[model samples]
Target: MLPVMAETLSQLVADSFEIAWDYLEATGELGNPDIAANHLLDTIEAMIRCGERRRLLLSNNAITAYQRFRAEQPLSLAS
Candidate 1:
């Protein structure tokens, strides 16, 4: 049971990251070197660790986090 639950949670995180990453890529907001992608995944995982389970909510929060991060570190984007 614990393993199953862990797997589901992992899936949720992956899905959320994918959703946010795809949106950023589509909007040309994602940068190179995978920094943006890594940030998105980190944000999503953190949210999950905080008990967030909904896929859309996780993705949305991650996207917002990424935007905020970018604002604070513009150099994260590609040249």
Candidate 2:
């Protein structure tokens, strides 16, 4: 599992907007098909990039934490 990462409130809002836009487009309710299609493509790309960055950040943070934990432990085991 990846380390916990916090997302800004704005990200949450943007996700909601994306979901709504997708729904509208799927239902044939979106006006200005050409413009909306372009915007949708852009938004999808941005969202994909954002997710990639988040995953990378979380993985880095987890590795850092694990290294710190190992460094702080003594070299002896007690049974």
Best candidate (score: lDDT): 1
Estimate the lDDT of model 1. 0.81
**TM-score for each prediction?**
0.80, 0.34
* Backbone clash numbers for all candidates listed: 0, 0
Question: On a 0 to 100 scale, what is the lDDT of residue 32 in model 1?
Answer: 66
Q: lDDT for every model?
A: 0.81, 0.47
What candidate 2 gets wrong by more than 4 Å, as runs, is: 1-3, 32-79
lDDT of 1 by residue, 1-79 (tens): 4545444877888888889988988988787637887888888888888888889999998888888878777473542
Pick out the ten consecutive residues of candidate 2 with the lowest summed lDDT.
58-67
